[model samples]
Target: MKTPWAVVVGEVADVKENSPDLPLKQQYYIPDEQEAEMAGSLGSPTDIADNGGYIVLRTAMAPEQMENLLRSTVHSIDPQLPLTQVQSMEHAISDSEAPRRFNTALITSFASIAVLLAILGIYSVIAFSVALRVQEMAIRMALGSQRSGIFRLVVLSGAKLALFGCGIGLAGAVAASRLLRSFLFGVSPFDPLVLTLATISLLLLALVASLLPASRAASVDLTEALRSE
Candidate 1:
């Protein structure tokens, strides 16, 4: 939709209402000569048109190399002119995105630490449970439980716990997706691909954590385990 500013603009070449940062406001662009003449009549004389304008150039060479040349060229035209915010396109983009990059890295670091702790916790719990069940395992082995059965028993138990945890987490994420909708960028809060990858990663880690204990249970010394009781 057009606003009262359309009078000054005459007609817009394009609109950028889709931009998240831009809001409905009075904004228009006009030629520098017409603007200067208008401003001169308003006692805000724009002499060399140094007050505003954007210089966009494309070059294969490094942007840094152009900075000095651009500044000197501008100064050569008018010695009193000052160049402000002279930065490369890459630098401008990086500067604008610096905060988001820092936040993502910080959150990722915490998530990694949380995953590592979960893996350690899983390993400890399964190992302790196996230790406590040594006598039961020994009796089972003596009563004709095969080594493969023992392995399956431990691994399957851990798998159940892992799957249960993932289910709970996925449910919680879905419930909170609305609350988190604004914070996510480039991806949806409930993006299925990301969620599936995360779930798979946790399950794999949990299975890895259980492997040592499962192997220990499967190859355990039946006589020692029974005699220790």
Candidate 2:
């Protein structure tokens, strides 16, 4: 038994009614044997069923090449027939999905840049705060505060600021969800998993950013800090 290839046979009426956006003037499918017979008779008035009226080309040809061949054959049969819209199914599907992929890539790039800037801002603020409190840290050390205690205090302070900022950010994200609805696919704007993961990631990043400053505070020398002040 010869292997049969499945090709889509779109009815002219159905295409016109259902897909007004499509530019295709007419489309049909016929079997390979009937292709030559229909070639001479194309553009002639003949009663044909919508489902199985057309010729089916050999499966060896790509959809694009097959579409081109069909167009050429039809145009040769009737030169006056205006070919306004002719496209392969592959091209149609690709065109339909291209915009979505491009949008996703753009949004992902912007999100990455925003996260990088946030991390840098957190690091700078924590570093500056630690620098300004150097003398205070030195005094605490001199008075008998443990190094671990100083480190914990600095980290906690940074954590409090990060938490506050994150809270505000979360509120803004919630409000902006409506505006982002059109861009989202396969995921909800307020997905709990996404929000939870984002929160945890941001908190971890903030902690990492504060680590260097916290370490410096813990290592402060009481004698030198007091002498400098």
Instruction: Estimate the Cα RMSD of every predicted model relative to the unseen true structure.
Output: 4.6, 9.6
Instruction: Show where candidate 2 strays beyond 4 Å.
Output: 1-92
Q: What are the models' TM-scores?
A: 0.81, 0.63
For model 1, residues 137-189, the per-residue Cα lDDT tens digits are 88899999999999999988888888998999899888988866755655697
- Candidate 2 lands at a TM-score of 0.63
Q: Candidate 1: where are CA atoms >4 Å away?
A: 1-28, 36-53
After TM-score superposition, what is the CA distance of residue 128 in candidate 2 from its true location, in Å?
0.7
Query: All models: lDDT?
Result: 0.80, 0.76
Residue 161 in candidate 2 has what lDDT?
Answer: 76
